[model samples]
Target chain A: MNSRLQAWLLALPATFFVVVCLGLPVLSTLATTFGEPAGPFVTYIQFFTSGFRRAVLLRTIEVAVITTAISLVVGFATAWVVARSPGRIKSILIIAAVFPLLTSVVVRSFAWMVILGKNGIINKALLALGILNEPLSMLYTEGSVIVAMVYLFVPLMILTLVGVLEGIPQDLTDAAASLGAPPSAAFRQVVLPMAVPGLIVGAVLVFTGSFTSYATPQLLGGDRQTMMGTFLYQRAMVTFDWVGASTIAAVMVVVTIATVLLMSRLARKLNPVVG
Target chain B: MKTRIHPALIAFSVFTFVFLIGPLIIIIGTAVSDTTFLTFPPQGFSMRWFANIFEVSAFPRTMVTSFTLAVLATTLSLMVGVPAAYALARFRIELPKFLANVFVLPILVPEIVLGFSLLKSVATGVGASIWTSLLIGHALLVLPYCVRVVGASLNSFDFSVEEAAVSLGCPRWKAFFVVVLPNIRAGVIAAFILAFITSINDVSVSIFLTGPGISTLPIQLLAHMEQFFDPTIAAVSVLLMGVTVAVMTVVEWTLGLTFLTK
Candidate 1:
């Protein structure tokens, strides 16, 4: 066989499997929304027209944005520390940062449930400290979901940022400082601009992660705090609203893809070389 | 001249680490609590919850199912992903771009979407069993990781040894097995571990794909938690974390966790 044919042949099996199993299924399911008798966009219309679903969609975006924003700040600080640390400490810190990722999301969310429950640690501690006469209802709320998601995804943000931060020379900031720029001004002018690409990458990951996350919202937020992921699950599995589910799924994919493309474009504009 | 990291930044990072790792520590602590309800800073110590993991039955059964499913899916992903990675790395072909995207399309799409899609198309449309649909979904889930990790490994490898083997008397295919495979063993192993862990821990896809009598460990735990708020779940979670720690230790020893950065 010619080299082209050989390469194509080599790539064929995985490509074929993915197309048949994943690609076709997702596409066909998206197409199912169009098959609705009322109209091609009826499911989407119904979804948007409903106050609850609109809230869910807005809440999903809100959670994702908040999670991404928080993760970026925390991850940047943590990554900066890890990246600048000496070799042994850097390795240890990276391991520490990544250790949570190795465990299941279910386990991690369960931990939050333990911490936030009425009789859980925080309530007990607050009670013991006389901080509150009554336990605050923390679990099964939007705040709880966001907190759990930040814990779940911040490591990803750190992983994405650390290498890029490490590649930046430390002297660049110092040079700006030595040139009579304030330290904060130096960071804003020198370090922050350069870190934009990594920031975008990390932001995109955390955003989409929390955007489509199922387990955390379902476990911690419950029905009271319905996000897109949990909404899709309820529509599909519980009510068997296939059209509604398909619409949600299609919208989610489109939103996720759009976020990625928009962020990549932003990253490219900011850092042409890396892009 | 050495620059100093700000004390405030150091303090903030310390807080972040505690936030990141604190929950797992709390879970571990709760696991050993003697109380019926999940609690931290135990009132007393007991091994009953660990024993209760066995008595729960779903925990042990689904653990086996999850392990078997993860192994099978990782194997399937490797079989499909290795050659694709090789072709992409070595071929210098234009189609590699399109093919690479297709291979990675699963990761780009929300896994919940993929899971629901598979449930609709494979299970309902094609009439495949839920178990088979799950296997297919999970394999697709991990396939991208397999390709990316192994492809990174392949890119760094010197292909000249395989070329030399081909030039000498060995067939091209045989040369790949004898020369290339041995060299990229670490990557393959790394990919396997990563894929296995991902498949096992997966909840988004598995949640949708699972049906009656065919639940993964995570799904089982999720269901168990919905019904009960007890230390048994904590015990089971601690055990699951143990598995993760063991796998990560192996990765640290062999490839170093830095590979995860890739």
Candidate 2:
């Protein structure tokens, strides 16, 4: 066969898979938004106008931002430690970081329930210490959701940053030190600026992961805080409002894509190498 | 050549590691507990909860369904993704960026959105079964991973040997199967394992695609937890964790952990 024909022939199978399975479905879902009983713009209008949905959207953004910020800070520290460690210790730490990601989200979320439940570990200890008269209601709250999400996603940020941190030569820091720059100053001026790309990439991953995650918010937040994912679920499955659900789903996709673009642009502007 | 990790950083790292793995250790601990209610540090130990998994009829069946689906999805994705990766990597193709992005877009899209979209499409069809929906969904989900890993191997591959074989009157197809496939075999295998794990662990997409009387392992476990709130789910979680750890070990051995970060 001619190489072009051969190439298309080779690519046909996967292209068909994406087109039929993903492209068609996503387009159809977007199409459904226009067919809503109220009107074409009704679902979108209601979504933006409704206080409850606006709150959910804002809460999702808030939780995702906080989770990303916290994950980046903690993950950066973990990655720095792992990157600087000797071989055996490095392997152990890296494995510890990646191992949690191998388990199911349900499994991890359930694990958090055991740890953060009303009569769970922390509460049990607090009660034992006589810090409270009764077990505190920790589970099924926004705080629980954030904690569980950070636990679930921090590993990703760490993995991302570790690669970047490892790529930096030791001489750069040593040069700064020889010039009388303190350890903290070297990190702030030389290391942190160089790590911006990884930071941006990690932030995007953590933010999007936390924002779009359904299982974490569902089980941990319970019915208390309805994030976008949970709200989309209830609207689609429980209420059978596919049109309204599609509207939410489309909005989420747009927001996520926009965030990715924005973050990368910001990264490029901040990092001369990328720009 | 010489450096020391800061003491405070080491402390923080230890805490982070503990925070990441502690919940899982607690889950395993809870699974081994003899008590009915869930507890982190068990009062006593027994294998009853582990054995209790078999008592739940739906659990085993759902597990079988999930395993079958994962296997089928992984196989199908390899079949589709390998050739596509080859074309994208080797062919002097136009619009390569857009085509590659199309293959990878599923991962970029949120699972909740993907699931909802797939559900809408499946709903419009005439009497589609849950299995068909799930298989299609999962295959789409894992296709990107297959392409990615395979594409990476193909990128750094020496194309001269294949061309040399072709110059010696060897057919193109034979060159691919006899030479190209063997070299990229490790990448293909890594992709297969990653895809299988992804398919097995998926709950968000599965939740929407699953129909009456059909559920994946995660969904089944989630439903069971909603009602029971016992150690049985913990037992199941441990078993699932064991399988994942084993799969990840294979991935680490074959492809190395750095392959994922890259």
Candidate 3:
């Protein structure tokens, strides 16, 4: 076969599979909201206009933003430590970050349930120390969801930031310090600016991961703190509200795509060389 | 002179490490607890919960399903993805960027959305079986990894050897099989392992795709946790972690963990 035909033939199966399995389904889901009898935008209007849904949307964004923010802060520190540490300790730290990633998210979230439940370690410890007479309910709360999400996603942030941080030489920071910039000033002026590309990538990953996450919010948040993921589940699987589910799915796709595009643009604008 | 990392930074890193790995340790600790309930620093030591994993009917059955699904999906993804990777790497294809984007688009979309979409369009609309939906979904999900990993390897590969083999009267296809495939073996294996782990561990996509008499291990575990607050879940989690560690060890040994970073 000619090279062009060979190339097309080689790419055919995967392209066909994706188009049929992924692209078509997603496009159909997006189209479902429009097919509603009332109007094309009816489901979307309900999604945005309804107080409950609006709350869920806002809460999803809130949890995702908080999770991303916390991941970035903690991840930067952890990544810095890992990047700057001697070779042996650095690999160990990298393993520490990568190991959790290998396990299931459901397993990780379940661990949080064990930790944050009413009779969980913290509650039991607090009660033993006479901090509280009664165990505080932590699971199913928004805070618990955020906490677990940060734990789940911080590793990703650390991995992303570690590569970029490792690329940055120690001399630059040392030179900054020698030139009268204090440690914090040196980090802010030198390290942080240079790390913006990694930070943006990490932020986007953590943000999108937490934003679209189903299990963590579902398992920990429960009905009391419904995020878009669980809400979409309930609508589709529980109630069979296809339009409603599709609307939520469509919104999620839009939000995720927007975030990715926005962040990439920001990364390009901030670090022209990397971009 | 090598500058010292600040004390506060070290302290923060320690805390973060603890925070990240603390829960897994707690689960493992709880698994060995002699107590019936889940507890950390666990009560007396016993292996009962580990044994109890077999007693849960769902765990074994769903584990088989998950394993089968993961293997099949990863294989399918590799079969589909490797050639595409080859084409993208070697051939001057029209719309290469668009095709690459299409391959990766599955991952770029939120997994939950993907799950729900498949459930709607495939399961409901097309009336496909749950197994078909899951297989298709998972294969699609892991295809990107195959393309990216294999593509990376193929990029760094020297194509001159393949050209030399073809110039020596070997068919182009045979040249690929003998010349290119063996050299990229490490990348292919790494991609397979990554895709396998991803398929087996996935809950978001599997959640919607699963039905009565069909569920993935993670979904089974989720349902089990919802109904029970015992150490069995912890036991299962620890076992899962063990499998993960073993898999990671294999990756580390064969390809090194650096492949994961790529």
Candidate 4:
């Protein structure tokens, strides 16, 4: 076979699978949006105007962004410590990092509900310890949703960062330290720059996973959170508003694709790989 | 190894572990409690809940159904995903690299969306039962993992040997079956475990599509936990946790866990 034909034949199955299974389903979802409830324009108008739609859209984005940012910051510190630790401790810590992800999301999120609940351990302990005069309504707040999400994904951040950090040579840090550079200064100058690729990869994972996370926000947020996930379920299954849910789903896809493209463009601009 | 105690770092790591394992411990504690109500540091140790879990009629059937679904899904994923991996590896496919990204991109896509697509696909087109719909949905979800692992191995293998096998009297099927199969066996087993765990633990899509007649383990957990706060959920959680950790350990040892972590 000609190389062109061979290449095509090889790639065709994967391409076909993606198109039929993933791409078409999503497109069909969009089609449902248009085909149902007086077509696309009306659905778009309804989604934009409806209070539930606006609130859920705004809240989902807010929770996702805050979770990603916080996970990145904390994840950096945790990974840095573990990466530099001794062998046995390092493996132990790595296992701990991956532990959160291994547990079922339902189980993990359910655990958060108990811990963050009003009469649950955290609040009850605070009450007995006199930390708070009253049991705070910490359970179903935006803070709880963000906290649960960040907690759900911090291990992902640490594991990803370790991949980046392990690739960095110790000699550079030693060279900087020998040159009279302080520990912090060496990390900033030598370590941080070299680890940017891994950092970008980790950041992309945390961003995308958090952005699309449903159970964490849904189970934790309850009434107040009513995120796009909850809204999507409500519209599609419960309320049968496929048109509105599809609009929301399309919006999410656009946002995800746009952010990834933006980051790739920014990664080229940063040139952190060389620096 | 001469590092002094980094108190702040130690505390942070401990806190993360606590955050990770705290709920599980609490649920386990609750399940053993003597009190009828759900209470932590449960009133007194009792095996009654485990007994109660068995007494429930739907529990046994649900377990069998869930296990069957996961097995079928994993098997189907290996069948379809492995070849696609070989093709992508052996031949230069003239598609946007984005398609590869799209193919493997469904790791944690919001379940509601998958649920919607699945429901739409089944209800409208395939008109299949929930069992078939679930099998298909899960197979699609797990296919990417199989592709990733198989493709990783195939990419690293010596392709010239395979070409030689084909060039000789050996037929294409024999070349692939005899030559390439042995090379990617580790990946195939690893992918099977990963796919099985993923399908078994599946909840998001199950929640949406599960009719009264069908319920995955995770779906059943959601149902019980919603209706009654008891420690049986914890017992079940422990069982589920065991499977996940077992899979993770095997994946780590066999495939090198770093691939997934990275």
Ranking by DockQ: 1, 3, 2, 4
User: Could you list the iRMS of every candidate?
Assistant: 1.1, 1.3, 1.3, 2.8
Q: Give the Å error, residue B12, model 2.
A: 0.8
Error of 4 at A164 (Å): 0.8
DockQ of each: 0.83, 0.76, 0.78, 0.49
lDDT of 1 by residue, B1-262 (tens): 5867999999999899899888999998999999998888876999899999999889899999999999999999999899999999998654646777888888899999999999899998999998899899999999998998899889989988888998898999899999999988888998899899999999999988888888999999999987988999999998888888888887886578976765
Per-model CA lDDT versus the true structure: 0.90, 0.89, 0.91, 0.76
Error of 4 at A21 (Å): 2.6
For model 2 chain A, the run of ten residues with the poorest summed lDDT = A30-39
User: What TM-score would candidate 2 get against the native?
Assistant: 0.97
Which residue pairs clash in candidate 4? B31-B231
Off by over 4 Å in 3: A272-275, B92-95
- DockQ leader: 1
Q: TM-score of every model?
A: 0.98, 0.97, 0.98, 0.92
- Model 1 clash pairs? none
